[model samples]
Target: MAIFTMMNSLAALLLFLISSSSLIAASDSPFILAHKKATLNRLKSGAEKLSVSIDIYNQGSATAYDVSLNDDGWSSDIFSIISGNTSTSWERLDAGALLSHSFELESNVKTVFYSSPAVITFRVPTKAALQEAYSTPLLPLEILSDKPRESTLDLAKRALAKYGSLISVISIVVLFVYLVATPSKSGAAKGSKKKR
Candidate 1:
């Protein structure tokens, strides 16, 4: 009878724990996360450009409404828009949903660029207040100076690709010249025997 009572107490404790955990999970609201990245490209006309990509993700259990992304972080005079707008808005972002935005920018002047974090704002269904989040900050980018230096391995690979046929032709020519300039010992021996 004592063992039966202990089993009942253990089952009650387990039920209580499970119920309380569910209550805790039900109170959670929507969580918004944002990420931003910029990449540099050199144009055929010797112009430098930047491509910016932004991603917004809803990671919480609830949906986010009136989701907006703003990226007016750079000076307009310095960086002109080549394509696409810097900001966008959406009606709703459901839980575990992701949205992406991209834009191209070009700068003619030679100067270093310092970018600011993008702003993301959304309204949660459960709350009256608006929630805001900032994207991760990026490092400074050099416009005139090459933003990133190439590795020696990458440089060698590019050089070989561009000058591969030239190198091959030079190697073949050198081999032919060596064979024509140097006489064979067998030819000399045969000539000496014929003369004798």
Candidate 2:
């Protein structure tokens, strides 16, 4: 009888522990994601510039509070901000919400610029410490270049890839014209007979 009682006690303790763990895990939390992209553009006056864009997404079970982003990783001596601010913050980002920020930068240093990833931070309801995330990293870019890096052959290949359907359509039209304008063998024979 005592062993049975002990078994029942153990079973009750196990059930209590399981219920508590599930209750702890049922709380909602927030998740923040940031995507960054940078593009290089050349001006007609032979000036080179850079454009940076960042997209923030909240894909969590709860809303995030105090969401902030900072993209000021570049050195001031190398690149100057043309427009827009480098840092921004929001009061809250609900679950599945999206935000976007952009800024333009210009440099005349004439060197290869290695970019850095943007940083994002936000607060979650279930945690005390602020959560941080890094954006997508970009590739190195050449600034203030005199000419494009692609050769004429590469440009031709790109053009062909872009207009391949037009070339095929022209070929089909030429074949159709040839088929309609040329006389058949039987027609040629009948014409010769008529002439004779």
Candidate 3:
């Protein structure tokens, strides 16, 4: 009877362990997705610039902790984060919530085409999480160098549109000064006839 009782206790312990482990795994796993969109613009000085926008979405039922973008693949000389924070201290993203960030990168190299991938890492919640992290696959971004050139006529038209009122005022002032300085046409003709 004692042997049978020991066997039953072992079975109970095994069942408890299995149930507890499953519960722990469910609570410690959070699902997240990262989306990236980039726009490339070439400046008038022939420098290429990129504006990148990132959106992170949490699809699980748990909140993500210490979320941040990993910069292992990004080179500072090639790309710079002009805006947004890439650090872990930004904020905790809740379930079904979305976090957005924007960055501007300028490259001196002209007529270049390249692709960069984005990786995001975050922590899952636990009783004592201890910074256990998860990462998403590399989100690929394509960068193309294509900027429309402004012709000289287009530049002049823009300038004229911007300063049209000021130019008109100056022109009116100059015309009034010329009229005051010179005699009238009729008076000039009469004076010439009298001289004759």
Winner on TM-score between 1 and 2 is: 2
Candidate 3 residue runs with Cα over 4 Å from true position = 1-28, 80-88, 111-116, 127-196
Residues 41-157 of candidate 3 have per-residue lDDT tens digits of 767776667776677877667888877765344566666666654433446888878888766777675434444446666776564543433333333433344447999999999
Q: Better model by lDDT, 1 or 3?
A: 1
Q: Predict model 3's lDDT versus the native.
A: 0.68
Model 1: per-residue lDDT, tens digit, 1-196?
9999999999999999889657744767767778899998777666679999999888777788999899999798788899999999999999889999999999776788899999999988778998899998878877757557889999999999999999999999999999999999999999999998
Q: How many residue pairs clash per model?
A: 0, 0, 0
| Clashing residue pairs for model 2 | none
Q: Model 1: what TM-score?
A: 0.62
Candidate 1 achieves a global lDDT of 0.87
Return the lDDT, model 1, position 37: 93
Q: Lowest-scoring 10 consecutive residues by lDDT in candidate 1?
A: 20-29
38-123 per-residue lDDT for model 2 (tens digits):
89898776667889999998766688899999987888988889999889999989887999999998887788878788999998
Question: Candidate 2, 181: how far from true, in Å?
Answer: 21
**Candidates' lDDT values, in order?**
0.87, 0.86, 0.68
The local lDDT score (0 to 100) that residue 92 gets in candidate 1 is 93
